[model samples]
Target: MHLTLGLHRAVRHEPSSVATFYEGRTHTFRQLADRVARLAGALRTIGVKTGDRVAILALNSDRYIEYYLAVWWAGAVVNPINTRWATPEILYSLDDSQSEVMFVDSAHKSKIDELREGSTTLEHIIYLDEEEKPNGTLSYEDLIEDGEPIEDSYRHGDDIAGIFYTGGTTGFPKGVMLSHTNIGVPAMTFLCEEYGFGSVSLHTAPLFHVAPLMYVIAQLFNGGRHIVLSGFEPAQVARAIEERKVTDVLLVPSMLHVLLDSPVVQKTNFSGLRRIWYGGSPIAETTQRRALEVFQPSGLVQLYGLTEIPVVALLSAAWHAPEMRKLRSTGRAAQENEIMIADANGREVPRGSIGEIVARGPNVMKGYWNKPVETETAIRNGWLWTGDAGYMDDDGFVFIADRFKDMIVTGGENVYAAEVENAIAKHPAVAACSVIGIPSHEWGESVHAVVVLKPGAREFTVEEIRHHCKDLIGGYKSPRSIEFKPSLPLSAFGKVVKDELRAPFWRDAIRKV
Candidate 1:
């Protein structure tokens, strides 16, 4: 089915139902469909033909959703930009994707001219805000107001739907090309699950990210209410949930903690909330327990996947109980996905053996845009090789150990950073921590930790941390050295940027990530 099929279905089934709630403004399905069709005409008027690349560089908003549907409505491909990226990184992606038309908000408008100058293919910029149109750019409202409605182009199945760029933690980001089938299969399967129909789903996570973007499609299919926040703020999210009676929301572990700690949550009634979907990183047991306390009635679901394959496995709410042994696992593979642990040679390994997580299904992405070599390297024999090192238990629950690159080899014994981080995080004084391999003349490489202490907590010595970890893990797995910081460096999606943490220590090392 086409990506736009959900929009058409929603319009047909509930034209007058509220489609989106954003910043005190509301739009019905009818209104959304009308604007999308007209915007599609506007895109065509500006020379956007079928298969043309159109990009949007803005935070979550009603207009962002419209941009996605309208682009697909015009039979064009959507390239959603990461709002947190640097100008140079943004320019690189624009040039690489050959995106000629871009939609820019006031927050990023100042860099428009420089981006245009730097990119070889970018030509037009649409001012995406309600404020006065910037000089030399087309106004978003004017385009929809004046342009005539157009027919749906019906791009479907293997047709390329969207190109989402990954965070360049290692180096430059690659554009992950996802087809309509890649999204639709999983979305259709979601309907069979507990994602409530006609539910009020809040979109606070950046819509550019694949996880939230997939929720958008899923909500469309369910003809549910979309509550769009400008971005994630603890108070705003708490208020939206209480005021709008939001039924479900998606958050990363970091966002979840902030939301739980927010003072607004104390006043908010969470009885209306049915689900709390979180992914992007594993949640600490402490955080999970706290979350269960705050949203007692809501189901906490864990999603696991990369941008290339959006839903490889889903840990349902039932597995999140404090006493459940599967709480740490990502849960079994989803209904339509086939997941396995594979070695470097692409051979499936025995259960409980750590290897690269490989997944295969209709939901797998088409390939990386314009990178055949990398595409071949990622997907072999119909399985997408997710660089995560993980294992499956006898019950088929998949447990992610760490990223293969993040695994530290000290004294010829392998150490997974995640295992060490979990132990460090358990220390009462530790707020957050990351483990990496640092060069050591004696052992060739030593496990090192960067930690952030809890606010107002007393400082502790490195020996205290190592002694604490030694009780839980092997001496080799304990951090050899410790550095205290106010905060850890994180990518836009909330994963710790290990490359930046390793750069200083590996500057002159023979091996580098």
Candidate 2:
């Protein structure tokens, strides 16, 4: 079955049920299905044929959800642009993916003029806003009203559904080709394992990212209601949860920290919240413990994976108890996937040994779009080599250490940045921190940290930080240098951009790892 099948089932099973909530408006399943079908027909009228690429650059909204379903219903592929990307990055993705039709919401309409000038393949621009149509663009609402409903394309199994781009940090973004099965199967598995029918799921995370998109699919599969927010703000999220009685939400660790810290959260009612899923980066133990205290009724679930392979493992709610020592782990392999730690030679490593994380399953992407060599290097013998360093315990729990590229070699010893960052996070004054290796004449490379202190926190000296870290980690692993900033640079999904932190120090280093 394809993704659209869920929509069809929802329409048949519960046509009168509320399907989506945006702002102060609500849409029933029947109305949503009709809009989706008409939007698909409208897309066809605009020359979107099967296998064509249609891109959307918008904040999270009901329109964004419609954009996803309509594109697939029309038998076209989706290329969701990262909302955090600048003009150059946006242009590169549009040109690289060869997207023909573009959708822009009111918030991002300004970029359309600039994007239109640089994009050669973007032929049609559809405005997704309630205001008057922009010059040279068709209104999204008009398309649904004027066009006729179309039949489902029934694109199933290996048919490509979307081309998700990755690697904007290191270099050019490569479109990772994900098929209908690659996404749908895993989403269904997650739905059965974690979600329940008629649940209310909140969409505050960016839809451009794979994790949130997967959550969207899971909600659809379970016939759950969706409450879409334009973007993530801690206060807004808390307000939405209290008002809408949202059952589940998917947030990165950074977003969780902000939400837990927000005073609005303490006053908001979390009685309806069932689960809070977090991932994209390792969360500090201190933050996790505090989260447990604040969100008492809500279970915290940790998901671990990359765009290439959506979710390889999950730390379930059962493993998140405060008393559980395994809370630090990324958890065991997901039921639908297999995870293994492999050395550089592609040989499996023993438990408790650090190595690259490799996964094999139906959830793995087909390959990198238009890059056969890179695809070959990434996947071998049916296993996708995730460039993440981690170790498995004897009981089969996986603990992520760091990304392969983020490993810091200081004085000939390996220092995983996550470990150092976790130690720094334990310091009460620190709100957020990122650890990286910097060039040093004496040590070859020295451990350096960029920290963001909690608001109104007293100033901390480098020596104080070093001493505090010494108590948690090895003295050698303590950061030799510390720089404080008001905030850290985060990606659309809330993962810290370590490469950005490492760039200035390594500009003349001939190579960046």
TM-score of each: 0.81, 0.81
Count backbone overlaps in model 2: 0
- Kindly list the per-residue Cα lDDT of model 2 for residues 298-351, writing each as its tens digit: 888888877889888988888888677888788888878999999999898999
lDDT of 1 by residue, 1-513 (tens): 888887899989999999998988899999999999999999999999999999999988999999999999999999998775556668878989999999999988888888878899998999999899878899999999999999999999999999988633234567899999898788765565688777999999888888888888889999999999988898889888989999989887768877877888888888999999887654565677889988997989888877889889988898888778887788889888999899889888999898989999998989988888889988899999988888999999998766655566554344668768877888998899998987664354678999999999987877888788764555656888889889999999999998899889878743342
Worst 10 residues of 2 by lDDT: 406-415
* lDDT of the structure predicted as candidate 1: 0.84
